[model samples]
Target: MPSVHFAPIFQRHLPVQSLEPQGRDLSECLYALFQTYPSLKHYLLDDQNRIRQHVAVFINNQALKSRTNWNIPLNDNDQIYIMQALSGG
Candidate 1:
């Protein structure tokens, strides 16, 4: 099963712990998380079921390119990190 971790900022709103869930893709994996943390569903995704603009998702240190369609493949030992995106001029 792949593991999902939230950044410290997000942890303030919920438990700051690692999550292990079963899924073949990123969306399904995150959906599993949503099942556990219902509030997180709104924080991470928009009404369209797409990743929010202020959020960033990384798979093994590489940031995901597709925000709307999270079909990235996952491995049993993969690590997924969800964090708030930092932006500046």
Candidate 2:
């Protein structure tokens, strides 16, 4: 299982701060998470099923490079992080 973590901003709206999801890839993990927390899907993804513009995703501390592809493979010990991107000057 890969450990998934939500940023503090997101945590405020979630039941748990972290979870270990059984999935082979990022997409699967996110799907599992949505199954557990249906409301989260709206926060993370848009109507087109794409990542929300204000959200960021990371795997093993590295920012996800492809917003269109969520099929990135996950390892048993992988750490996935979902955060609300900060912006403003």
Candidate 3:
């Protein structure tokens, strides 16, 4: 199973979690993680089940280019990390 870790930057907005072993694939694993931590569903993804704008997810050090709909494949022992994007004016 692959491990997907979410950042605490969205904790206040939603009391979810940080690290979780999310089986495989992005959608399925993410959905499972959210099922364990429901509050994360709304914060990490929008009503249409798409990734939020201020969030950045990387699979094995590669940025998710698919944006709203990602197409990255996963295998056992893979690591996925999610972080909140930083912006400065």
Candidate 4:
């Protein structure tokens, strides 16, 4: 299982602040999370099933480079972080 942590902004609206999702890749892990919190899907992904433009996902403290590619493999000890991206001056 991989540990997934959500930023405080997201956590405030969700039931959990973190989770240990069961999956081999990012997509599967997100799917498992959506199963538990269906509403989260709308906040994290767009209509195309891609990560929302304002959202950011980091794996093992490294930011994900491809928002459309959710197949990134995960290790049992991996740490996944999801948050709202900050922008503007």
Provide the lDDT at 13 for model 4: 59
The superposed Cα distance between candidate 3 and the true structure at residue 49, in angstroms, equals: 1.3
Instruction: Provide the RMSD of all predictions against the true structure, rounded to 1 decimal.
Output: 1.2, 1.1, 2.3, 1.0
Clashing pairs in 1: none
Instruction: Write candidate 4's Cα lDDT for 1-89 as tens digits.
Output: 89999999886458788999899999999999999888899999999998998999999999999888999999999999999998999
Query: How far off is residue 27 in model 1, in Å?
Result: 1.2
Q: How far is 10's C-alpha from truth in model 2 (Å)?
A: 1.9
Better of 3 and 4 by lDDT: 4
Order of candidate numbers by TM-score, starting with the best: 4, 2, 1, 3
TM-scores, each model vs. reference: 0.91, 0.93, 0.80, 0.94
* Candidate 1 vs candidate 2, TM-score winner: 2
Whichever of 2 and 4 has more TM-score, that candidate is 4
Per residue, candidate 2 scores C-alpha lDDT tens digits across 44-69 of 99998999889999999899987779
Quantify all predictions' global Cα lDDT against the true fold. 0.88, 0.90, 0.76, 0.92
List candidate 3 segments past 4 Å from native: 11-18
Which scores better on TM-score, 1 or 3? 1
By TM-score, the best candidate is 4
TM-score of 2: 0.93
- Higher-ranked by TM-score: 1 or 4: 4
Error of 2 at 14 (Å): 1.8
Model 2 residue 64 CA deviation (Å) reads 0.7
Off by over 4 Å in 2: none
